[model samples]
Target: MSPTTKNAGGDRAGGLRGELTPRRITALAAAVIALVFVFENTKEVEIRLLIPEVTMPLWLALLAVGVVGVLCGVLLVRRRG
Candidate 1:
């Protein structure tokens, strides 16, 4: 019956619908679909660098790339500091 309680209820309802415009939803959906191809089950594949061939499981390759990216970001930040 309190005025503050009514205001809080209205705010919660608004939040459930989200605050994003239609454009944000389309962009997010496209990004997720694109990543689906990157993580989908794939057999070991060979990547050729220079004159050498490196064979690795698709998932392992993805994990290594992600870790390398994080390390690079950290190094860059430390160097900047």
Candidate 2:
């Protein structure tokens, strides 16, 4: 009935207690990135800039893009409320 209390099976073997925190998600992402970088076995994709076209290693490009995305997200969230 209350927030602190759990009903029958609420805290069972397969309960929602195993929620993924931000730290866990970040660590998992880092591990996956490391694995991909080491393997370098991803499908090929082309990148086009304003002036020229370039071919790059997929995993390195993805990590770079992801870093940019994280920076933008942080800037947006940190803006005045």
Per TM-score, the best of the predicted structures is 2
> Lowest lDDT 10-mer window, candidate 2?
8-17
Q: Which segments of candidate 2 are over 4 A away from where they belong?
A: 1-44, 79-81
Tell me the tens digit of each residue's lDDT in model 1 across 1-81. 865666635665655376778888886886577467557846798988689999987867776776687689778878541
* Model 1 TM-score on a 0 to 1 scale: 0.43
TM-score of each: 0.43, 0.45
Relative to the true structure, candidate 1 has a C-alpha RMSD (angstroms) of 7.9
Cα lDDT for residue 50, candidate 1: 85
Report, for every candidate in turn, its global Cα lDDT versus the true structure. 0.72, 0.75
